[model samples]
Target: MRRRGPTRLGRAAALALAAVIVVTGCTAEPPPPEPQPGRLVGAPAPLDVTEVYLQQRIAAMTLREKLAALVMVHVPGTDAARIRSVLDRYGFGGVIIMGDNVGGPARTVAGLTGALSSEAGLPVLTAIDQEGGIVRRLREDDAAAARELRGLPASAAEQAFRTRAALVAEAGVLINFGIVADVTPDSSSFIRSRTLGESPSAAAERVAAAVRGELGTVLSTLKHFPGHGASPDDSHISIPRSSIGMRAWRATHAVPFRAGIEAGAPLVMMGHLQFDRISPLPASLSPTWVTILRQQLGFDGVIVTDDLLMLQRSGLPEYENPLRNAIRALAAGNDIVLFVLPADPGSVGVDLTGLLDALERAVGDGRLVEARIDASLHRVLSLRRAASGLVEPYVDCGPKCWGESPRSLALADVPPTG
Candidate 1:
């Protein structure tokens, strides 16, 4: 079949269309630059990279996911299956291993961490209260030097803690609840033996060195904030009262906390001690103290409660209910409330699940705002993200996220290495 050629009018029309395209500069925008090879499509970026990404991750999560990030539950066993059941069900930010959880096996913890972390969406921080000396959890390690901070020089103390941290890190543990910053001079002080010891100056130096020793690998924690040694009353039994005034506190007690903060410790566990003169409430449940920790001392990291169960141990009218205490702690600006329920003598017979249930009801009832959950989750996620290597130290502090702290990476968006 013969094909018909374009007529004069058709050719003229085609020429006119070509001229119009050239004049108007219409060209399909160069095929989007050949699809940009090596670009990461849906690869997870750092949580602090953008506010939208962080929020999206937060939004994508269920209430359980958010709650899991907020609490570190203790499942007391070296049995990998029991631990895996908890992690698989809750997706908790961490698992706090007590002395019982650390059986004599060299690789029990490492094996547990590997098994659980492989199934987790984020890094599951392997936690231990390795205070060394009397409170050492990993006694199997010959190099455990938690008690060595008692009288060692700052340089020596730093080396001791750094060595301790390396040994712990080798077990795949990412967090340490050591470095007691409390300075109590009393011989009978409960935490005295576990602390950096008598001199505030020396305590501060030793605490900061220990913090710096871990650098980015392990998240160092300075615990029992606002100093616990001042009160002879045991917080584990009841809410201890610190009779010291704010002026006295500033001069002495606040010293080690300040130094640890300056050294960039990622977590601070607030004590249940009440500074009656300065603040009427327990430090763990007191907004006044939390504010002091944040604004006055400049601790921008995660502030966790010592144990709601301890405050409940007082059996005082205000401290009885674990559910109420969790609410009060959250309302008081605490990012995490440690409820060692069921295991805590004070928490006997109480449902460990009640904490999350109460929090969920509170959020649903508007007693707690979703934003509050988000803010708490942001700090929580930031810590997890930082610890997981998805973000850098204090990523929210710089120009990223516009100086606002937003620490979360979309699990799907994060690169494979993390």
Candidate 2:
């Protein structure tokens, strides 16, 4: 009864006070929403301009032409003429050089690259795995020449890596420095000794530092995505499996990859190991893993698969067919497929035609999406143009290339700092 007595006046005063509070709060503004884990909040999105140009290019290409881009084969021996013929016939977009491909000096490799690029009428991505330590391919018999510099404390490792990158770039081939090898490190681990320590945060930081340090000297590729450190078996001989769950993976193994992506690493190499919690397929063939990489990790670069032939030879019945594996990799978001000759001596028969036919059929059957193909082709072309300056065109030093002029040496020594 007492409250009812002052109803009208009191009610009016209370309403006015409520309005004032609302206005003041509105002007102050609420705090910004907290970003979710793995979300790319402040990062710039990958440009779509390349995708548009690539679509137009692919639309004009024939089935055979598209198939050629999908296959990246190894060149046997140092015979430049034979390599050139293979490249010209297929219009191959790139070559993965191994020990067999390194025949002569820096000048010789440059000459070979120039010849292949000229005949193909397209800038080619000539790459090598000159990862230091036992993986070094360019130098032989000089153990000091192939120094293992992976696991040095971050600062020293980065400087040494930059020097290594500069040297490989000087050799006239783009490099695939093995930034990450998926082997798990135990208490007495020699392999993990090269890795950036056990913690994912530490690993990611070191890898990103290496990428940033090598920015202008060479193109850096972050390999074996989705955390290869957990794999117990070697993919080279068997299909390795990681017992860790997706949650554990996200917290640990995935840390370095996310860091590398944030640093704008131009290329990411997919691993061949399988994670059973997410998908039965290997990371190279799993859409969840690839989609997470592109969308969540904010990586919009070329994704190349670990060699398909290795999967087939891994003693796994499921990987017996390399063509099917290639198709799966494409569907899973990988942009390139590597087919290299085995290190085993006296091996014959590569079966290139079979691989080509399989890829062709996959495209025809819609197993490999046309849009995805265009996206990948555009990335490849962009990388080629960026690396070789194909669009601008530099001096084509024909045969008597070395030391013809001091100017030539000056030009060659200046590295492409992208």
Best prediction by TM-score:
1
Off by over 4 Å in 1: 1-53, 118-121, 142-148, 341-349, 390-418
Per-residue CA lDDT of model 2 for 110-178, tens digit only, reads 676666666332466777876566677666323221124334566655675677677677677775655
Which pairs clash inside model 1?
43-413, 44-413, 44-414, 47-408, 132-146
TM-score between candidate 1 and the true structure = 0.78
> Candidate 1 lDDT, tens digit per residue, 1-418?
1111233465467579778878999976533322222323332222334344456678789986786677776776678787778766766666776777777653666776666564333566667787667777778655435356565677877777777787677667888887789887787877777778577887898889889886665788888988897797788988888778999999898999999999999899999889989889988888899899999999998888886777666879877787877777887888877755354444342455666788788778876677777898888776665555443323223322222112322322432221
How good is model 2 by TM-score? 0.75
